[model samples]
Target: GESVGLHLPTLSVQEGDNSIINCAYSNSASDYFIWYKQESGKGPQFIIDIRSNMDKRQGQRVTVLLNKTVKHLSLQIAATQPGDSAVYFCAETRGAGNMLTFGGGTRLMVKP
Candidate 1:
């Protein structure tokens, strides 16, 4: 219902630098937030996750910050690389196994 009015697109980013991935969520009641990285022709691999109660969470070379005040979320990647190049996705779940809703998506590119 809420996703029916959302945008489904992909964003491209350059490599060997920092990347900020953004996602717009339609529901304001969501709680659990998970970020995933997917390479071509493969399933998503979990990168990091954060709870609605928390403002920020970090992982290996990646950080996920949630702004409940603005109802927005972001994933920051440090020192992106060609090997790190892949599509990033944000998945929101209200509770355990609550049918995760995915955002548009993001593509990261690395240049030598």
Candidate 2:
């Protein structure tokens, strides 16, 4: 995304490697975690999700780690590419509706 209200702008990353983005949540009741990727000027697409009961989840070249102990979360991307470049956001939901609480968001710059 094009940066939050007044927080830090973004971080730059190179292609063909891994990238990790961090996020923190306020609610302790949150039990579900999801990661989303948003290309420029588009809605965020679901990436992967993990339940509070689980600590780790993996997907195609991607991994989501949840730390309920600290109310922290992270997303990891492997062999990143230009197509993989975008703004990534982490979300947490308490229950139904799949409602998501987004983080500060970060832009992934894949060097060609």
Candidate 3:
């Protein structure tokens, strides 16, 4: 079965450096993609998102890039901070009433 997934289980980065997290989705029909950040004891929070029609989207300190041809997606964080440390997951939705398929999360660790 096709699924949306991440390429890495974890990532470690310096507090002041940039970070890139990658994801891959097998369903070409998925029209919406979202990146979420989950803190240790909290619910997942929305970080950024991109539609299939767009290749990239940017937020305050984050950017999401989509490559439909390769079914690849990535999130880029600028100047990663300790507060930015969390488990990040990618989710995809198709034709939906808010139904989403989530990928395995990638734990991001920011070293001070």
lDDT tens per residue, model 3, 54-102: 9999999899999999999999999999999999999998874868999
Candidate 1: global Cα-lDDT? 0.79
RMSD of each: 2.4, 4.1, 0.7
lDDT of 3: 0.96
lDDT of 2 by residue, 51-76 (tens): 98999999999999888797778888
Residue 41 of candidate 1: its Cα lDDT?
A: 91
Model 3 regions lying over 4 Å from their true place:
none
Ranking by TM-score: 3, 2, 1
**What lDDT tens digits, residue by residue, belong to model 1 across residues 1-112?**
6541113345455666887888777788898888889999999999999999999988888999998886788888888777777888888887566878887677766675
For candidate 2, the C-alpha RMSD (Å) to the true structure equals: 4.1
Question: For model 3, what is the alpha-carbon lDDT of residue 72?
Answer: 100
lDDT of each: 0.79, 0.79, 0.96
lDDT, candidate 3, residue 19? Answer: 98
Regions more than 4 Å wrong, model 2 = 1-9
User: Which candidate gets the maximum TM-score versus the true structure?
Assistant: 3
Return model 3's CA RMSD, one decimal. 0.7
